[model samples]
Target: MNKPNQETLDELKAIYVQKIKAEFPKQLKNFSDKNAKEHQLSQLRGYLHKLVGSGESFGYTDITHTARAAESIATSLMSESTKDKPSRLTYLVKLLEKLAGIVDKIEIESPVTLHSGANFTDRQSNAKLLTVGQAHIAKTERKHTICVWVIDDDESVAAQLSEQLLSFGFDVAYFLSCAAFKQALLSSQPHFVIADVRLEDNSDFYRCADLHRIDLKSFGLIIMSAFDDFHARIKAVRSGAITYLQKPINVARVASFIHEHKNKIQLHPERILIIDDDTDLSALYKSQLEAAGMAVHNLSDPRKVMAAIQEYQPDLVLIDLYMPDFSGMELAAVIRQFDNFTSLPIVYISSETDNQRQSKAIATGGADEFITKPVSADILITALRTRVKRARQLNALISKDSLTGLLKHSAIKEAVKSEIARTSRDRQSLCISMLDIDRFKRVNDTYGHAVGDTVIESLANLLTQRVRQTDHVGRYGGEEFMLVMPGCDAESAQVILDDIRERFSNIEFTVGNKGFHCTVSAGFVQLEASVFLPTADSLVEHADSALYEAKNTGRNRVVQSITARI
Candidate 1:
């Protein structure tokens, strides 16, 4: 787990310290009245519990320990079984007095201490821009250089895996032992490590331990073994292996897994919505999450939550359990009522320490998790990242085409609509390309549907590989595909699509002992906000018409839309 900026964190901590100083004494004074003590003890306990959580999170060890002790006493007094209430009350007051003294002694560091680490916010923003053609080609070119290191005692296994990864555009290095890998780590770091479980020295289980001791940062570990024993699997999990593969590996599967994992981890930004009545606390959270590269929106008013969700379209919702108008559970229930947000992740962040209340909130509101306040920044980021990644995966399953893994027809149309709106606002150029496999039905009739399916998949792969990451590709219908390229002018798009047409024609398809080549015909419509008012339907219709002309003129060629030609 990574942390946000140290200076911002220090500022937030200082604010929290001042907050404790201003509020604790007033809260503790309520305990002095015997009649009010019974009524106010619960409130006091809640306050102290908050201190205990936030203090530890902000590195205030003394405050956390003291508050924990005072909270325990308060909880005991509230219970019906407590008999020596006066004695416990006296002890609680002394602890509270000690806490006040500790707060007075606390000093915030003035000068900032900067830590050199990757900027999460920049990475997230780049991911969003990648979808809109804002990031340049260099970024995509750099992705080709992802380094993967393989450690296997078997020379043949290492060589085979390394060669496969290299063919997939990964930089690959292989070593026979952990020692060699460790030695290589002195110079450069690899993005991923594929290690064998059975090392020559039988120190396989300690490989991950060695990496941890050396403090390796930001790399994935994969463990492979010939033995599928339960103990081996357990050790792999204990060693923090991200994935485990058995012997007789599918090289293609490994390559696909790496590509999928890399794209999923690197390309998505976490969108978070925070609803809390305490404006200061919400601001602190907003700053922290944003600094960590998440797009965050915070609201002090729960009444506007639905509208915010609609506009922001968050990946996860973080709600404070106690609010002025509606509790976190109540808001979650309202969100769950809508079918669109039913599967959205809703997490409760609060200082309430009662186990029963937390459980009740989760069950009643259909919340995913109940996170107690005072969570470390690293833990918070990691937890939210895991949830967001899972949610995105689920979304892809629902919206992506099964065969080609591109957006489905409806999803891509919706994407075009959204992109068109964005282009209109930004005053940018957008291109929509419609592609059809030439004589695709004839091929199915001659070679069978399976071969035709292969042709479609091949074209999908080619288009996806050739296009920019910011572009969207979809299976529009049988034998047809659609591409939405933002910030791309007509001339550039024409050349790119022509290049794809040439490449697709060169790919040889085989059926039994026969081998043949297939060609694709494509037509594209480019829209400049200054020249034309582009709607999604018109873009699709014009592109399709151009595609129809291309098919009529020549079976394999790229054509610009007639509307754009004029």
Candidate 2:
């Protein structure tokens, strides 16, 4: 995610070209031999393979293709020639001569110009392979502690909110008045400002808001008020408030709101897996792509492509078409064999220029596109970004709920089953929760289905905001939702779900001019791998039973399954 050192990259390119040129005499001698030894042929094959990868990367297409031809000949000869040896040897020798000529003529551009079209971030860490979930955890670990400043004349309100935020893992400071808050701001700023709309006759708060809008535009401002009037809301909006919360402030809701904002601002770098036998070329691709705000993993051995895919879960795969044992098309087909990866984008980035063969590769339904070698950095970035975005949109359309944008019923069930299998293997705990809006039929009858739908959307957003990136939330159907949390115990699940329950109860929904609140009941079952053999259906059923108990006792609560309570 950092800006790549173009000078370093260009220098590397120059070094590669020079290295090839220096090795030209030995390569020529090997190719000239009618009966080359296996070791000599093997060395020639390795050299040609490097050229096939790096030549195109450095924009030497002629050299890449020449090397490819020579490499093919070397491979055939090493494997015991089945073709006319004299003709093959002549062709191979000519190809090696052509490759040497191309290398001699290769030009290295100094301080290569980098495209600034994409916004790149500072990764701060060394490049490595990690799944999106693992990346999220790493990001969280590196993130600075969020500090929240609560400005309210009401001491009780400020203290209660501050305490709750502290419990929710935020550093909190409360000021009794705007003056005290302003004084603190002069010293240092908090990540968020939760200010009462009326602090000392409301005049001081408005003045403070004006100061914040002008001087501290970066920090998030959450305006809290007892008033639900249009005028008050407009004033808050004008003052650059991110959200206006009605007092009787739900701390969990505020926390969720903050998290939503954070998610929006966070840079989730695109994941890319480059499968190529050439480590040097793969390294170059990794560096260039990472500079353009993508996470890249390089795997030289095609045999480990499956393991890399499962572990790294890349958004797009860039494969060299001519690896030793398995071709890129073969690997692509293997990846497509899995239902989960059928939609994943596979692109062949090689020097292969045969149009008919390229068409055949794509027609096989394995590869999405063929990117010929010598692609400009800008073109490569644009092509990859476009493919990844479209793929995600397509995947979402197939698996996401139309109403809430969470996973659909079957998709969620499948996700649960997969997680259960993983938990069984890892011998970790898994929590499955079922949630339903309280008295949803009454809500629809009173406020109509449109308002009911709005409530459902609101809850969906809340669940998405509160859950971890590793957790899965799905619209189970209608007003019900399902949450799957791997490696979570019942007690932790209860705590999280209870907070969400309390927060949902405090979310005010307006129908016409009347503002009202809604509630939800949640039931979760935690499966201990040592004690229980978990299945998706059994987990859902137990959680549903717990939800029934929660509804029976009282609405607006979270309950752990009696059968699996820890």
Candidate 3:
């Protein structure tokens, strides 16, 4: 099955869920009627069966299972005489209510598809809503929200800290001792940690060392020392504290730090690939694209187009229409042969102004948009941005893992191919990592699909947070993720995979009241141009083989491809 991107999956899921919810209650109510029960059970069964068939495609396995169970119960109730089995009818109604609750709780993670109405055009209305909502969220979330940990032994200092932080819309957590602060750090994961240099029994020595071990470099840490001596200040700096405050604490400086770093801390920039045979043209396009603040790759050789694309797995592509030996039309045609590249945007740019020539360019393959040269800088930039944005939207429609916000299996394959192609042409190293959630099926079977989805979402978030900005990470079907790392060799990629494996192994998940931990097994293949010339299928297969080795050897570790070593 082709996997849709997050936006596409969310839209589809929302529509499917809304449709089921709207229709099911009416169907259930009709079923309870004296004459309606005779005919309604068949309709209910049919609807539930349809949902079961389609739900997994949208990453709504929980909804699928519920529908399946409801279908079974409805079937059983229908078999019994209604007059003799009133309890059976009640059970069916209760099941329908439960299904309704599940549907209600399902969040609509993407924009809804607009429907036309007689009054206002639905598309226009939805566009307006999206614009407003986006602006609002961007404004709201961009504001600095400081989170501080107060590790003061005094009860009054701890209590006052919370009130002071709260006045400025900051979140504050108090810890009475070093041990209490350490325990709070494990669960709360606050943005900043503040501690007194002098703790009870001089335990600050070990406590400061422990905090440093947790990689608090990115976070703000201030040591409050009552002693004004230079020795105490030096001790605080050596212990890995950012700043040492002498007795008096400045709330203003702390606020300033939060404000300065708030926007600085963000997810990595998205990687983009540009394929054009003209070196001058590629550079020109790359400059404009880079100015827009996107990571861009430019390739001038059509022969290595696929290799470059696979290595970068770019979010979008801008291909020149005419090349020396192979035209952009021919290259796009070749790309279309691969299933992963079917929906990828391959925009053609050329000086060919004839209408017939433009039509011919598009006719060669799946050309999304065309640009006639000499391309205007602003016009070209707008066109590329629009194509990239649309690609993301289309991917959301068809290639998103609804719960995880990652690329669906088919999308991930396409992205990997594009990345590999880019890396190969650029002679940059590239890596592909296949990650499998260990004992995932067991989790699903034991705690139901709802809990399983939470686990998947959490893992996806962690992978996204850990990977480099240039890396491509996506959901490679059920309980598995695929990562494409450009400019990374086998050793560096292994280090990254191992770090992710360790972090994921320690993450604890709780569903209702039951807490459980899960681990991931990874197989990664890092390829240099000298070593395995980049092809999408070859790279993916190599990585998959390594992943198989990791799983066979034992879960929760990373294995590199032996083929690459050879």
Candidate 4:
């Protein structure tokens, strides 16, 4: 296997370091609380167990052994028998102390940039701005329509904050007070409400029951207070505030907070495959997962686990511990054999809650997690959501371009290969296109690299918006991109690409006071159902030839590959 380029390694490293920073504090707090509640201890043990397994994989050998030992002690303490809890707690503390030292020693060249103004943040913000357009275009582009209700008595603050949020693409609604908000709620409810902690009439915050309405997901509550009293904060939390912000807040930070929470409610529905012989229980689980906006498929046949996984391409899998044909652990081992499914999470669902036995099963079977039966709906949802989110983050770190958020070079190739197989198997029409920015090198030389980057990002954003949702768009490399259009012929593909090319060329870009325009040359190859299908590599080569042809012809047009049997 070839070693990855330095850029890819740097991206992967940066993501791992960020994960450590974000998670280490919570893990340390949990580890230090030897007298924590049982559930807290259980959570700590599970986290440490996962950390132990993943830390080594990411080359954090410094803490892996210590985390592994701590996990063992945690497992012992969490077991039903409590006779050894005192000794295990002492030993776990020692291990944690040592682990802290190890964590301090593990070095990462770069830190995660969470705040604005950082290079990554600036890139993301600028790229998003490229998508800034008319109200309806923004609405169509948004994955979920997030309507934020801001209830504050201060008209000045409310007006300014509303404008800022609207800039961030949120549908904003403002109210003068809680009374107005409640009246509006009676007719329509927003996804999130940001209200002052105190009202002039002292009316109770939102009715908690309204948020618990089963017909819809729970609404978000954010409390804004001018007071710094401990009781005020506590009251806000008790009143169901997901976030509490002080007065004179940075509106941008507030928007970021709300958007972060909004993302929780609007994630792309993760796909999950469940293999359990208990049909009734599986169906119940399936419905619960679906209610959380996950795509779920449940199969009663344990023997078909591999086939089901390949077909569903699920982010996570749930398997019953006891099945008539095979045990969940055995099936998990089989699934791990396939390289494509190696990172897919396999969680075992069983009635047994014994910590020791669960640890052993996890280790022996190479599974990610074990959930005892009779779990609460919230716990199940939270557990699966956390795993899926982490897996996706990891996947993005390795597969996504750092600057543009498009698939990396290698990932795009893999996508092309997969598309070829899919089109061949289904006998569907498909088109592959290559696009290159005209005179990109000249832009970088003329107006610094940052301006050049802005040009690239603008084009990427245009492609993301103009293309159909079903199309696959990736940044093949610098100044070049690949587009795979399934169920489309050369004519339709050309129409779409040509339109994008025109729109992209019309985008007015500026560096200081000087302004300029950019254009793209695109070429496509269509796989006709009646013609002999070409290999992915062959198609890519033909598309490249066509792209150059477009560049040679006039420098800003779409050209079709001359790949017919003629």
Candidate that would win on TM-score: 2
Per-residue lDDT tens digits of candidate 1, residues 190-286?
7678888777766654664466464433477777888898888887777666788986665445654565556634434588998877654665676
Score residue 381 of candidate 3 by CA lDDT: 67
- Per-residue lDDT tens digits for candidate 3, residues 84-157, read 46666666667778778877777766546544221222443364456436532222332233466778777686
Give the poorly placed runs of model 1, Cα more than 4 Å off. Answer: 1-53, 61-98, 110-138, 141-270, 275-312, 323-326, 330-339, 363-366, 376-386, 417-431, 439-455, 462-471, 485-519, 526-538, 555-557, 564-566
Lowest summed lDDT across 10 adjacent residues in model 2 is found at 115-124
Model 3 lDDT at residue 389: 69
Candidate 2 lDDT score at position 441: 95
Ranking by lDDT: 2, 1, 4, 3
RMSD, candidate 2, Å: 8.1
- Which RMSD values do the candidates have, in order? 8.8, 8.1, 24.7, 19.7
Q: List the residue pairs that clash in candidate 2.
A: none
The residue ranges of model 2 lying beyond 4 angstroms of the native Cα positions read 5-32, 37-46, 56-268, 530-532
Q: What is the C-alpha lDDT of each candidate?
A: 0.76, 0.77, 0.67, 0.71
The per-residue C-alpha lDDT of model 2 at residue 456 equals: 84
Clash pairs (backbone) in predicted model 4: none
Model 4 residue runs over 4 Å out of place are: 1-267, 468-470, 529-533, 564-566
lDDT of 4 at 447: 89
